[model samples]
Target: MPPSSALRRFFVCPSHRAFTLVELLAVIAIIAILAALLIPVAGAMRKKARETRCLSNLKNAGMAFFNYQAENRDRFPPACERSTGSWRAFDTLLGYTDATAELLHCPLDEIPRVRSLRPRSYAMNDPLWQRESWPGVSLNDMDNPSRTILLSEWFVDGNTTGSESYCDLGNPGTFAHANGTAGNVLWYDGHVSQLSSASHDTNQQYYNFR
Candidate 1:
Protein backbone atom coordinates (compact mmCIF):
# COMPACT_ATOMS: atom_id res chain seq x y z
CA MET A 1 0.00 0.00 0.00
CA PRO A 2 1.23 3.63 -0.72
CA PRO A 3 2.13 5.96 2.18
CA SER A 4 -0.55 8.28 3.63
CA SER A 5 -1.09 11.80 2.11
CA ALA A 6 0.42 13.48 5.22
CA LEU A 7 3.70 11.49 4.81
CA ARG A 8 3.97 12.35 1.09
CA ARG A 9 3.40 16.06 1.85
CA PHE A 10 6.16 16.05 4.55
CA PHE A 11 8.68 14.49 2.14
CA VAL A 12 7.84 16.88 -0.71
CA CYS A 13 8.09 20.08 1.35
CA PRO A 14 10.81 19.80 4.00
CA SER A 15 11.36 22.90 6.17
CA HIS A 16 14.16 25.25 5.01
CA ARG A 17 17.40 24.87 6.96
CA ALA A 18 19.32 28.02 8.02
CA PHE A 19 23.08 28.03 8.29
CA THR A 20 24.38 28.13 11.87
CA LEU A 21 26.27 31.18 13.13
CA VAL A 22 29.53 29.17 13.22
CA GLU A 23 29.10 28.18 9.55
CA LEU A 24 28.66 31.81 8.52
CA LEU A 25 31.80 32.82 10.45
CA ALA A 26 33.76 30.02 8.81
CA VAL A 27 32.87 31.25 5.32
CA ILE A 28 33.95 34.79 6.18
CA ALA A 29 37.27 33.50 7.51
CA ILE A 30 37.92 31.56 4.31
CA ILE A 31 37.38 34.65 2.17
CA ALA A 32 39.74 36.67 4.37
CA ILE A 33 42.47 34.05 3.98
CA LEU A 34 42.17 34.00 0.22
CA ALA A 35 42.40 37.78 0.07
CA ALA A 36 45.56 37.82 2.18
CA LEU A 37 47.18 35.29 -0.14
CA LEU A 38 46.61 37.49 -3.20
CA ILE A 39 48.15 40.70 -1.80
CA PRO A 40 51.78 39.91 -2.64
CA VAL A 41 50.81 38.53 -6.03
CA ALA A 42 48.95 41.74 -6.86
CA GLY A 43 51.96 43.83 -5.91
CA ALA A 44 54.27 41.74 -8.10
CA MET A 45 51.92 42.04 -11.06
CA ARG A 46 51.94 45.82 -10.76
CA LYS A 47 55.73 45.86 -10.69
CA LYS A 48 55.94 43.71 -13.81
CA ALA A 49 53.47 45.97 -15.58
CA ARG A 50 55.66 48.98 -14.87
CA GLU A 51 58.65 47.04 -16.02
CA THR A 52 57.02 46.33 -19.40
CA ARG A 53 56.37 50.04 -19.88
CA CYS A 54 60.00 50.86 -19.12
CA LEU A 55 61.13 48.29 -21.66
CA SER A 56 58.82 49.76 -24.29
CA ASN A 57 60.39 53.17 -23.75
CA LEU A 58 63.83 51.69 -24.26
CA LYS A 59 62.70 49.95 -27.42
CA ASN A 60 61.37 53.20 -28.83
CA ALA A 61 64.74 54.78 -28.15
CA GLY A 62 66.54 52.01 -30.04
CA MET A 63 64.26 52.38 -33.05
CA ALA A 64 64.86 56.10 -33.08
CA PHE A 65 68.58 55.46 -33.29
CA PHE A 66 68.03 53.13 -36.22
CA ASN A 67 66.04 55.80 -38.03
CA TYR A 68 68.85 58.20 -37.29
CA GLN A 69 71.44 55.74 -38.55
CA ALA A 70 69.62 54.95 -41.81
CA GLU A 71 69.46 58.57 -42.88
CA ASN A 72 73.13 59.16 -42.00
CA ARG A 73 74.64 56.31 -44.01
CA ASP A 74 74.37 53.73 -41.16
CA ARG A 75 76.34 55.90 -38.74
CA PHE A 76 74.94 55.96 -35.22
CA PRO A 77 74.28 59.20 -33.37
CA PRO A 78 77.14 60.89 -31.59
CA ALA A 79 77.67 60.10 -27.96
CA CYS A 80 78.28 63.76 -27.18
CA GLU A 81 77.71 67.00 -29.00
CA ARG A 82 80.92 68.61 -30.23
CA SER A 83 79.86 72.17 -29.38
CA THR A 84 79.84 71.42 -25.65
CA GLY A 85 81.76 68.08 -25.82
CA SER A 86 79.33 66.59 -23.29
CA TRP A 87 77.42 63.32 -23.53
CA ARG A 88 73.93 64.39 -24.56
CA ALA A 89 72.68 61.70 -26.92
CA PHE A 90 69.14 62.52 -25.87
CA ASP A 91 69.36 66.05 -27.21
CA THR A 92 70.98 64.94 -30.44
CA LEU A 93 68.38 62.24 -31.11
CA LEU A 94 65.50 64.57 -30.40
CA GLY A 95 66.77 66.90 -33.09
CA TYR A 96 66.88 64.06 -35.58
CA THR A 97 63.65 62.20 -34.62
CA ASP A 98 61.55 65.21 -33.59
CA ALA A 99 60.31 63.15 -30.64
CA THR A 100 59.49 64.68 -27.30
CA ALA A 101 62.42 64.62 -24.88
CA GLU A 102 60.28 62.99 -22.25
CA LEU A 103 59.85 59.88 -24.44
CA LEU A 104 63.41 58.95 -23.56
CA HIS A 105 62.92 59.33 -19.82
CA CYS A 106 62.55 56.13 -17.82
CA PRO A 107 59.12 55.70 -16.28
CA LEU A 108 60.55 54.80 -12.89
CA ASP A 109 62.65 57.92 -12.75
CA GLU A 110 60.76 60.37 -10.56
CA ILE A 111 62.83 63.44 -11.40
CA PRO A 112 60.72 66.35 -12.57
CA ARG A 113 61.02 67.36 -16.22
CA VAL A 114 61.62 70.97 -15.14
CA ARG A 115 64.62 69.83 -13.11
CA SER A 116 66.10 67.57 -15.81
CA LEU A 117 64.77 66.84 -19.24
CA ARG A 118 66.55 63.47 -19.67
CA PRO A 119 66.48 62.55 -15.95
CA ARG A 120 69.98 60.95 -16.08
CA SER A 121 68.37 57.49 -15.92
CA TYR A 122 69.46 56.23 -19.32
CA ALA A 123 72.78 56.33 -21.19
CA MET A 124 74.14 55.10 -24.48
CA ASN A 125 76.67 52.34 -25.02
CA ASP A 126 80.16 53.81 -24.89
CA PRO A 127 81.57 51.36 -27.45
CA LEU A 128 79.23 52.39 -30.26
CA TRP A 129 81.52 55.21 -31.37
CA GLN A 130 84.31 57.51 -30.39
CA ARG A 131 83.37 60.91 -29.00
CA GLU A 132 85.97 62.59 -31.22
CA SER A 133 84.91 60.99 -34.54
CA TRP A 134 81.43 59.43 -34.40
CA PRO A 135 80.12 60.44 -37.83
CA GLY A 136 82.79 58.43 -39.60
CA VAL A 137 81.75 55.19 -37.85
CA SER A 138 78.74 53.19 -39.00
CA LEU A 139 76.56 50.43 -37.55
CA ASN A 140 77.37 48.33 -40.63
CA ASP A 141 80.99 48.23 -39.38
CA MET A 142 80.03 46.82 -35.96
CA ASP A 143 79.89 43.17 -34.89
CA ASN A 144 77.29 41.14 -33.01
CA PRO A 145 74.65 43.82 -33.11
CA SER A 146 72.23 41.28 -31.70
CA ARG A 147 74.25 40.78 -28.53
CA THR A 148 75.65 44.28 -28.17
CA ILE A 149 73.81 46.74 -25.97
CA LEU A 150 72.59 50.09 -27.26
CA LEU A 151 71.42 51.78 -24.06
CA SER A 152 70.64 50.85 -20.47
CA GLU A 153 69.76 52.30 -17.09
CA TRP A 154 72.37 54.79 -15.89
CA PHE A 155 74.60 54.40 -12.88
CA VAL A 156 76.19 57.52 -11.40
CA ASP A 157 79.39 56.84 -9.49
CA GLY A 158 80.42 60.42 -8.63
CA ASN A 159 82.77 60.46 -11.67
CA THR A 160 80.25 61.20 -14.40
CA THR A 161 82.57 62.57 -17.07
CA GLY A 162 82.23 59.40 -19.14
CA SER A 163 79.55 58.29 -16.71
CA GLU A 164 76.74 58.67 -19.25
CA SER A 165 77.45 55.09 -20.20
CA TYR A 166 75.43 51.85 -20.06
CA CYS A 167 77.59 50.52 -17.23
CA ASP A 168 75.21 51.02 -14.32
CA LEU A 169 75.26 47.33 -13.48
CA GLY A 170 74.62 45.68 -10.13
CA ASN A 171 72.99 48.72 -8.55
CA PRO A 172 69.72 48.85 -6.66
CA GLY A 173 68.33 51.83 -8.55
CA THR A 174 69.51 50.77 -12.00
CA PHE A 175 67.40 47.59 -12.09
CA ALA A 176 64.38 49.10 -10.39
CA HIS A 177 61.96 46.72 -12.09
CA ALA A 178 63.61 43.45 -11.09
CA ASN A 179 64.15 44.02 -7.41
CA GLY A 180 67.72 45.09 -8.24
CA THR A 181 68.80 41.70 -9.59
CA ALA A 182 68.44 42.29 -13.32
CA GLY A 183 67.82 45.31 -15.49
CA ASN A 184 66.41 45.72 -18.99
CA VAL A 185 68.88 46.46 -21.80
CA LEU A 186 68.12 47.45 -25.38
CA TRP A 187 70.53 45.62 -27.65
CA TYR A 188 71.91 47.06 -30.86
CA ASP A 189 69.68 44.79 -32.97
CA GLY A 190 66.41 46.29 -31.69
CA HIS A 191 65.60 43.74 -29.00
CA VAL A 192 65.25 44.22 -25.24
CA SER A 193 66.11 41.75 -22.49
CA GLN A 194 67.14 41.54 -18.85
CA LEU A 195 70.81 41.65 -17.89
CA SER A 196 71.71 40.14 -14.58
CA SER A 197 74.06 41.95 -12.23
CA ALA A 198 76.51 39.06 -12.17
CA SER A 199 76.81 38.86 -15.94
CA HIS A 200 76.94 42.61 -16.50
CA ASP A 201 80.70 43.01 -16.06
CA THR A 202 81.73 39.43 -16.80
CA ASN A 203 82.41 40.09 -20.47
CA GLN A 204 83.92 43.23 -21.93
CA GLN A 205 82.04 42.62 -25.19
CA TYR A 206 78.68 43.11 -23.45
CA TYR A 207 79.34 46.82 -23.15
CA ASN A 208 82.39 47.28 -25.41
CA PHE A 209 81.58 46.00 -28.89
CA ARG A 210 83.57 48.50 -30.87
Candidate 2:
Protein backbone atom coordinates (compact mmCIF):
# COMPACT_ATOMS: atom_id res chain seq x y z
CA MET A 1 0.00 0.00 0.00
CA PRO A 2 1.27 3.58 -0.79
CA PRO A 3 1.70 6.14 2.04
CA SER A 4 -0.93 8.91 2.27
CA SER A 5 -0.05 12.55 1.31
CA ALA A 6 -0.76 13.69 4.90
CA LEU A 7 1.63 11.02 6.33
CA ARG A 8 4.39 12.13 3.91
CA ARG A 9 3.83 15.78 4.91
CA PHE A 10 4.08 14.85 8.60
CA PHE A 11 7.40 13.04 8.07
CA VAL A 12 8.80 15.91 5.97
CA CYS A 13 7.72 18.58 8.53
CA PRO A 14 9.37 16.91 11.52
CA SER A 15 10.32 19.45 14.22
CA HIS A 16 13.59 21.37 13.82
CA ARG A 17 15.94 22.02 16.71
CA ALA A 18 18.49 24.79 17.49
CA PHE A 19 21.41 24.80 19.86
CA THR A 20 20.56 25.63 23.48
CA LEU A 21 22.44 28.39 25.34
CA VAL A 22 24.59 25.89 27.21
CA GLU A 23 25.69 24.11 23.99
CA LEU A 24 26.49 27.41 22.25
CA LEU A 25 28.52 28.60 25.23
CA ALA A 26 30.47 25.34 25.34
CA VAL A 27 31.44 25.66 21.66
CA ILE A 28 32.56 29.26 22.18
CA ALA A 29 34.65 28.21 25.19
CA ILE A 30 36.35 25.45 23.18
CA ILE A 31 37.27 27.90 20.41
CA ALA A 32 38.71 30.33 22.93
CA ILE A 33 40.83 27.64 24.55
CA LEU A 34 42.16 26.45 21.19
CA ALA A 35 43.01 30.01 20.18
CA ALA A 36 44.83 30.57 23.46
CA LEU A 37 46.90 27.42 22.96
CA LEU A 38 47.88 28.34 19.38
CA ILE A 39 48.84 31.95 20.09
CA PRO A 40 52.15 31.08 21.80
CA VAL A 41 53.00 28.52 19.14
CA ALA A 42 52.44 31.15 16.43
CA GLY A 43 54.67 33.59 18.28
CA ALA A 44 57.44 30.99 18.61
CA MET A 45 57.29 30.19 14.89
CA ARG A 46 57.67 33.89 14.04
CA LYS A 47 60.71 34.16 16.31
CA LYS A 48 62.31 31.10 14.68
CA ALA A 49 61.73 32.52 11.21
CA ARG A 50 63.39 35.80 12.22
CA GLU A 51 66.31 33.91 13.73
CA THR A 52 66.80 31.95 10.51
CA ARG A 53 66.86 35.17 8.50
CA CYS A 54 69.40 36.62 10.93
CA LEU A 55 71.62 33.57 10.40
CA SER A 56 71.46 34.02 6.62
CA ASN A 57 72.44 37.67 6.93
CA LEU A 58 75.42 36.76 9.08
CA LYS A 59 76.50 34.06 6.63
CA ASN A 60 76.41 36.49 3.70
CA ALA A 61 78.35 39.04 5.72
CA GLY A 62 80.97 36.38 6.42
CA MET A 63 81.24 35.68 2.69
CA ALA A 64 81.71 39.40 2.10
CA PHE A 65 84.63 39.34 4.52
CA PHE A 66 86.31 36.57 2.53
CA ASN A 67 85.69 38.39 -0.76
CA TYR A 68 87.05 41.59 0.73
CA GLN A 69 90.17 39.77 1.88
CA ALA A 70 90.78 38.07 -1.48
CA GLU A 71 91.19 41.46 -3.15
CA ASN A 72 92.77 43.36 -0.24
CA ARG A 73 95.93 41.31 0.53
CA ASP A 74 93.94 38.69 2.50
CA ARG A 75 93.41 40.99 5.50
CA PHE A 76 90.19 41.58 7.41
CA PRO A 77 88.83 45.07 7.99
CA PRO A 78 89.65 46.78 11.25
CA ALA A 79 87.21 45.95 14.03
CA CYS A 80 86.20 49.60 14.11
CA GLU A 81 87.52 52.95 12.98
CA ARG A 82 89.22 54.95 15.65
CA SER A 83 88.00 58.34 14.45
CA THR A 84 84.70 57.63 12.70
CA GLY A 85 82.75 54.46 13.72
CA SER A 86 82.50 50.69 13.29
CA TRP A 87 79.96 51.01 10.48
CA ARG A 88 82.52 53.01 8.54
CA ALA A 89 84.96 50.12 8.69
CA PHE A 90 82.35 47.63 7.48
CA ASP A 91 81.34 50.05 4.73
CA THR A 92 84.68 49.33 3.05
CA LEU A 93 83.22 46.01 1.84
CA LEU A 94 80.20 47.63 0.17
CA GLY A 95 81.84 47.31 -3.25
CA TYR A 96 83.54 43.98 -2.66
CA THR A 97 80.60 41.67 -1.82
CA ASP A 98 76.93 41.36 -2.80
CA ALA A 99 75.93 42.58 0.71
CA THR A 100 74.37 46.03 0.99
CA ALA A 101 73.49 48.31 3.87
CA GLU A 102 70.08 46.67 4.06
CA LEU A 103 71.61 43.19 4.33
CA LEU A 104 73.69 44.37 7.26
CA HIS A 105 70.57 45.06 9.33
CA CYS A 106 69.06 42.20 11.33
CA PRO A 107 65.37 41.38 10.85
CA LEU A 108 64.86 41.23 14.62
CA ASP A 109 66.45 44.61 15.28
CA GLU A 110 63.89 47.05 16.69
CA ILE A 111 66.01 50.06 15.78
CA PRO A 112 66.51 50.00 12.04
CA ARG A 113 68.18 53.34 11.57
CA VAL A 114 69.83 55.30 14.36
CA ARG A 115 71.47 57.97 12.27
CA SER A 116 70.38 59.06 8.80
CA LEU A 117 71.84 55.76 7.54
CA ARG A 118 70.66 52.28 8.45
CA PRO A 119 72.36 51.06 11.59
CA ARG A 120 74.48 47.88 11.46
CA SER A 121 73.24 44.88 13.48
CA TYR A 122 76.38 42.72 13.24
CA ALA A 123 79.76 43.59 14.75
CA MET A 124 83.24 42.42 13.96
CA ASN A 125 85.01 40.49 16.71
CA ASP A 126 87.28 43.18 18.14
CA PRO A 127 89.87 40.62 19.20
CA LEU A 128 90.03 39.22 15.69
CA TRP A 129 92.32 42.09 14.89
CA GLN A 130 94.75 43.90 17.16
CA ARG A 131 93.76 47.29 18.62
CA GLU A 132 93.96 50.44 16.51
CA SER A 133 97.50 50.95 17.79
CA TRP A 134 98.51 47.71 16.00
CA PRO A 135 97.82 46.45 12.49
CA GLY A 136 94.76 44.53 11.35
CA VAL A 137 94.83 40.72 11.44
CA SER A 138 95.15 38.68 8.26
CA LEU A 139 93.86 35.20 7.42
CA ASN A 140 97.40 33.95 7.76
CA ASP A 141 97.58 35.26 11.29
CA MET A 142 94.71 33.13 12.64
CA ASP A 143 95.85 29.92 14.34
CA ASN A 144 92.52 28.20 13.64
CA PRO A 145 90.24 29.89 11.14
CA SER A 146 87.52 27.31 11.79
CA ARG A 147 87.22 28.28 15.46
CA THR A 148 87.70 32.06 15.21
CA ILE A 149 84.64 34.27 15.40
CA LEU A 150 84.60 36.98 12.73
CA LEU A 151 81.22 38.66 13.10
CA SER A 152 78.35 38.35 15.60
CA GLU A 153 75.03 39.95 16.52
CA TRP A 154 75.86 43.26 18.24
CA PHE A 155 73.93 45.68 20.42
CA VAL A 156 74.50 48.58 22.77
CA ASP A 157 74.66 48.22 26.54
CA GLY A 158 74.97 50.57 29.51
CA ASN A 159 78.59 51.51 28.84
CA THR A 160 78.36 51.29 25.08
CA THR A 161 75.31 53.30 24.06
CA GLY A 162 74.39 55.15 20.88
CA SER A 163 74.64 53.76 17.31
CA GLU A 164 77.71 51.60 17.76
CA SER A 165 78.33 48.30 15.95
CA TYR A 166 81.14 46.58 17.80
CA CYS A 167 81.15 43.59 20.18
CA ASP A 168 83.83 43.43 22.87
CA LEU A 169 84.01 39.95 24.37
CA GLY A 170 85.18 41.67 27.55
CA ASN A 171 81.54 42.75 27.95
CA PRO A 172 79.85 39.45 27.20
CA GLY A 173 76.63 40.54 28.92
CA THR A 174 76.07 43.16 26.23
CA PHE A 175 75.78 40.68 23.37
CA ALA A 176 72.19 40.39 22.17
CA HIS A 177 70.37 37.56 20.35
CA ALA A 178 66.96 37.20 18.78
CA ASN A 179 66.52 33.98 20.76
CA GLY A 180 67.53 35.83 23.97
CA THR A 181 69.80 32.99 25.14
CA ALA A 182 72.16 32.47 22.18
CA GLY A 183 73.32 34.40 19.11
CA ASN A 184 74.35 33.55 15.55
CA VAL A 185 78.09 33.93 15.18
CA LEU A 186 80.02 34.01 11.88
CA TRP A 187 83.34 32.24 11.95
CA TYR A 188 86.39 33.15 9.88
CA ASP A 189 85.94 29.93 7.87
CA GLY A 190 82.65 31.40 6.52
CA HIS A 191 80.32 29.26 8.62
CA VAL A 192 77.59 30.47 10.97
CA SER A 193 76.58 28.88 14.28
CA GLN A 194 74.50 29.64 17.37
CA LEU A 195 76.44 29.95 20.61
CA SER A 196 74.81 30.44 23.98
CA SER A 197 75.64 33.57 25.95
CA ALA A 198 77.02 31.43 28.74
CA SER A 199 79.29 29.47 26.39
CA HIS A 200 80.37 32.64 24.65
CA ASP A 201 81.54 34.13 27.94
CA THR A 202 83.05 31.02 29.46
CA ASN A 203 84.84 29.84 26.31
CA GLN A 204 87.67 32.25 25.57
CA GLN A 205 88.41 30.29 22.37
CA TYR A 206 85.52 32.02 20.53
CA TYR A 207 86.85 35.48 21.36
CA ASN A 208 90.59 34.81 21.12
CA PHE A 209 92.01 33.81 17.74
CA ARG A 210 95.49 32.98 19.03
Candidate 3:
Protein backbone atom coordinates (compact mmCIF):
# COMPACT_ATOMS: atom_id res chain seq x y z
CA MET A 1 0.00 0.00 0.00
CA PRO A 2 3.03 2.34 0.51
CA PRO A 3 3.97 4.80 -2.28
CA SER A 4 6.66 3.60 -4.72
CA SER A 5 10.22 5.05 -4.29
CA ALA A 6 10.19 5.82 -8.05
CA LEU A 7 7.09 8.10 -7.63
CA ARG A 8 8.66 9.98 -4.72
CA ARG A 9 11.90 10.47 -6.70
CA PHE A 10 9.99 11.79 -9.73
CA PHE A 11 7.91 14.36 -7.80
CA VAL A 12 9.91 16.76 -5.69
CA CYS A 13 7.88 18.49 -2.86
CA PRO A 14 6.91 22.18 -3.31
CA SER A 15 8.65 23.13 0.00
CA HIS A 16 12.01 22.19 -1.59
CA ARG A 17 11.55 25.02 -4.14
CA ALA A 18 11.56 27.75 -1.46
CA PHE A 19 14.55 30.17 -1.36
CA THR A 20 17.32 29.50 1.08
CA LEU A 21 17.91 31.91 4.00
CA VAL A 22 21.10 33.25 2.40
CA GLU A 23 19.34 33.89 -0.91
CA LEU A 24 16.44 35.62 0.81
CA LEU A 25 18.83 37.78 2.82
CA ALA A 26 20.65 38.77 -0.38
CA VAL A 27 17.43 39.84 -2.04
CA ILE A 28 16.38 41.87 0.98
CA ALA A 29 19.76 43.60 1.06
CA ILE A 30 19.50 44.55 -2.59
CA ILE A 31 15.99 45.95 -2.02
CA ALA A 32 17.19 47.95 0.98
CA ILE A 33 20.04 49.44 -1.04
CA LEU A 34 17.71 50.37 -3.86
CA ALA A 35 15.32 52.06 -1.47
CA ALA A 36 18.11 53.97 0.15
CA LEU A 37 19.17 55.36 -3.21
CA LEU A 38 15.65 56.13 -4.41
CA ILE A 39 14.29 57.82 -1.31
CA PRO A 40 16.37 60.97 -1.78
CA VAL A 41 15.56 61.13 -5.47
CA ALA A 42 11.87 60.80 -4.74
CA GLY A 43 12.11 63.59 -2.17
CA ALA A 44 13.78 65.91 -4.66
CA MET A 45 11.14 65.13 -7.25
CA ARG A 46 8.39 65.99 -4.80
CA LYS A 47 10.05 69.29 -4.02
CA LYS A 48 10.33 70.18 -7.69
CA ALA A 49 6.66 69.34 -8.15
CA ARG A 50 5.75 71.69 -5.34
CA GLU A 51 7.81 74.44 -6.95
CA THR A 52 6.05 73.91 -10.24
CA ARG A 53 2.71 74.16 -8.56
CA CYS A 54 3.76 77.41 -6.91
CA LEU A 55 4.69 78.88 -10.28
CA SER A 56 1.37 77.83 -11.78
CA ASN A 57 -0.52 79.51 -8.98
CA LEU A 58 1.39 82.70 -9.57
CA LYS A 59 0.64 82.60 -13.26
CA ASN A 60 -3.06 82.21 -12.55
CA ALA A 61 -3.00 85.23 -10.26
CA GLY A 62 -1.26 87.26 -12.94
CA MET A 63 -3.91 86.28 -15.47
CA ALA A 64 -6.58 87.23 -13.00
CA PHE A 65 -5.09 90.70 -12.65
CA PHE A 66 -5.34 91.30 -16.39
CA ASN A 67 -8.91 90.06 -16.35
CA TYR A 68 -9.63 92.41 -13.47
CA GLN A 69 -8.31 95.30 -15.52
CA ALA A 70 -10.57 94.36 -18.42
CA GLU A 71 -13.58 94.63 -16.13
CA ASN A 72 -12.37 97.63 -14.06
CA ARG A 73 -11.74 100.06 -16.90
CA ASP A 74 -8.11 99.12 -17.44
CA ARG A 75 -7.07 99.62 -13.84
CA PHE A 76 -5.33 96.78 -12.04
CA PRO A 77 -6.77 95.52 -8.80
CA PRO A 78 -5.83 97.51 -5.71
CA ALA A 79 -2.81 96.39 -3.72
CA CYS A 80 -3.01 94.54 -0.43
CA GLU A 81 -3.55 97.59 1.80
CA ARG A 82 -3.45 101.25 0.97
CA SER A 83 -4.97 102.79 4.07
CA THR A 84 -5.95 99.95 6.40
CA GLY A 85 -4.41 96.91 8.06
CA SER A 86 -2.10 94.23 6.63
CA TRP A 87 -4.45 92.90 3.97
CA ARG A 88 -7.55 95.04 3.85
CA ALA A 89 -7.26 95.58 0.11
CA PHE A 90 -7.01 91.88 -0.58
CA ASP A 91 -9.85 91.28 1.85
CA THR A 92 -12.03 93.74 -0.05
CA LEU A 93 -11.11 92.20 -3.39
CA LEU A 94 -11.93 88.70 -2.21
CA GLY A 95 -15.03 88.81 -4.41
CA TYR A 96 -12.80 89.58 -7.36
CA THR A 97 -10.10 86.93 -6.73
CA ASP A 98 -10.68 83.21 -6.69
CA ALA A 99 -9.94 83.63 -2.96
CA THR A 100 -8.66 80.09 -2.78
CA ALA A 101 -5.93 79.84 -0.14
CA GLU A 102 -3.75 77.58 -2.26
CA LEU A 103 -3.55 80.21 -5.00
CA LEU A 104 -2.05 82.57 -2.48
CA HIS A 105 0.59 80.20 -1.16
CA CYS A 106 3.99 79.12 -2.51
CA PRO A 107 5.66 75.83 -1.71
CA LEU A 108 8.97 77.58 -1.07
CA ASP A 109 7.44 79.72 1.60
CA GLU A 110 8.59 78.87 5.09
CA ILE A 111 5.83 80.72 6.88
CA PRO A 112 2.90 80.28 4.56
CA ARG A 113 -0.29 81.21 6.36
CA VAL A 114 -3.33 78.98 6.22
CA ARG A 115 -6.52 80.80 7.09
CA SER A 116 -9.96 79.47 7.77
CA LEU A 117 -11.19 80.89 4.51
CA ARG A 118 -8.00 80.37 2.48
CA PRO A 119 -4.25 80.07 2.71
CA ARG A 120 -1.86 82.74 1.42
CA SER A 121 1.75 82.22 0.24
CA TYR A 122 2.42 85.66 -1.10
CA ALA A 123 1.41 89.29 -0.44
CA MET A 124 0.38 91.99 -2.86
CA ASN A 125 2.16 95.31 -2.93
CA ASP A 126 0.54 98.09 -0.93
CA PRO A 127 -0.03 101.01 -3.26
CA LEU A 128 0.63 103.43 -0.48
CA TRP A 129 3.80 101.62 0.44
CA GLN A 130 4.91 100.36 -2.99
CA ARG A 131 4.52 103.65 -4.88
CA GLU A 132 1.95 102.29 -7.32
CA SER A 133 -1.26 104.25 -7.79
CA TRP A 134 -4.41 104.26 -9.92
CA PRO A 135 -5.51 106.94 -12.40
CA GLY A 136 -6.97 109.09 -9.68
CA VAL A 137 -3.67 109.35 -7.82
CA SER A 138 -1.11 109.56 -10.60
CA LEU A 139 -0.80 111.11 -14.03
CA ASN A 140 0.93 107.81 -14.92
CA ASP A 141 -2.26 105.80 -14.86
CA MET A 142 -1.39 104.16 -18.17
CA ASP A 143 1.80 102.88 -16.59
CA ASN A 144 0.33 101.82 -13.27
CA PRO A 145 -1.18 98.57 -14.43
CA SER A 146 1.82 97.84 -16.59
CA ARG A 147 4.28 98.51 -13.79
CA THR A 148 2.44 97.04 -10.87
CA ILE A 149 3.73 93.85 -9.31
CA LEU A 150 1.23 91.06 -9.69
CA LEU A 151 2.69 88.35 -7.43
CA SER A 152 5.90 87.50 -5.61
CA GLU A 153 7.24 84.86 -3.25
CA TRP A 154 9.39 87.39 -1.44
CA PHE A 155 8.66 86.83 2.24
CA VAL A 156 11.75 88.32 3.79
CA ASP A 157 12.49 91.70 5.33
CA GLY A 158 15.41 93.42 3.69
CA ASN A 159 16.80 96.86 2.84
CA THR A 160 14.01 97.28 0.31
CA THR A 161 12.27 100.54 1.07
CA GLY A 162 8.50 100.84 1.23
CA SER A 163 6.80 97.49 0.68
CA GLU A 164 9.49 95.79 -1.40
CA SER A 165 10.47 92.31 -0.18
CA TYR A 166 12.93 89.50 -0.97
CA CYS A 167 12.03 85.85 -1.49
CA ASP A 168 14.13 82.74 -0.88
CA LEU A 169 14.37 80.64 -4.01
CA GLY A 170 16.12 77.75 -2.33
CA ASN A 171 14.91 74.36 -1.19
CA PRO A 172 13.48 73.59 2.24
CA GLY A 173 15.56 75.15 5.02
CA THR A 174 16.69 71.76 6.23
CA PHE A 175 18.12 70.63 2.88
CA ALA A 176 21.58 71.32 1.44
CA HIS A 177 19.88 72.97 -1.50
CA ALA A 178 18.85 75.72 0.88
CA ASN A 179 21.15 78.24 -0.71
CA GLY A 180 18.85 80.93 -2.09
CA THR A 181 18.63 80.09 -5.79
CA ALA A 182 15.86 81.79 -7.69
CA GLY A 183 12.46 83.21 -6.90
CA ASN A 184 9.18 83.31 -8.81
CA VAL A 185 7.99 86.74 -9.92
CA LEU A 186 4.73 87.41 -11.69
CA TRP A 187 4.76 90.77 -13.39
CA TYR A 188 1.86 93.05 -14.22
CA ASP A 189 2.07 91.87 -17.83
CA GLY A 190 0.98 88.44 -16.64
CA HIS A 191 4.43 86.99 -17.18
CA VAL A 192 6.35 84.82 -14.77
CA SER A 193 10.13 84.71 -14.44
CA GLN A 194 12.63 82.94 -12.24
CA LEU A 195 15.31 85.16 -10.78
CA SER A 196 18.69 83.95 -9.59
CA SER A 197 20.94 84.88 -6.70
CA ALA A 198 22.56 87.84 -8.41
CA SER A 199 19.08 88.80 -9.43
CA HIS A 200 18.14 88.93 -5.78
CA ASP A 201 18.44 92.66 -6.09
CA THR A 202 14.81 93.25 -7.01
CA ASN A 203 15.51 96.93 -7.30
CA GLN A 204 17.65 96.13 -10.29
CA GLN A 205 16.44 97.04 -13.78
CA TYR A 206 15.47 93.45 -14.58
CA TYR A 207 12.74 93.35 -11.97
CA ASN A 208 11.78 96.98 -12.24
CA PHE A 209 9.27 98.18 -14.80
CA ARG A 210 12.03 100.01 -16.62
TM-score of each: 0.68, 0.72, 0.69
Q: Lowest lDDT 10-mer window, candidate 2?
A: 161-170
- All candidates: CA RMSD (Å): 5.8, 5.2, 5.8
List where candidate 2 sits over 4 angstroms from the true fold.
1-15, 96-99, 111-113, 127-136, 155-175, 178-181, 201-210
**Per-residue lDDT for 60-97 in model 3, tens only?**
77666555556766555445322322453345445567
Clash count list over all predictions? 0, 0, 3
Error of 3 at 209 (Å): 5.6
List the lowest-lDDT window of 10 residues for candidate 1: 167-176
The Cα error of candidate 2 at residue 102, in Å, is: 3.1
Supply the TM-score for candidate 2: 0.72
State the local distance difference test value for candidate 1.
0.65
lDDT of 3 at 173: 23
Candidate 1 lDDT by residue in tens digits, 68-166:
788877788667543443555666677666457666666666534223223555666655654646453576765787777777774544354445454
Give one digit per residue, the lDDT tens place, for model 2 in 114-172. Answer: 46334667766665654455566788877877777777775445254322335422333
- The lDDT, on a scale of 0 to 1, for candidate 2 is 0.67
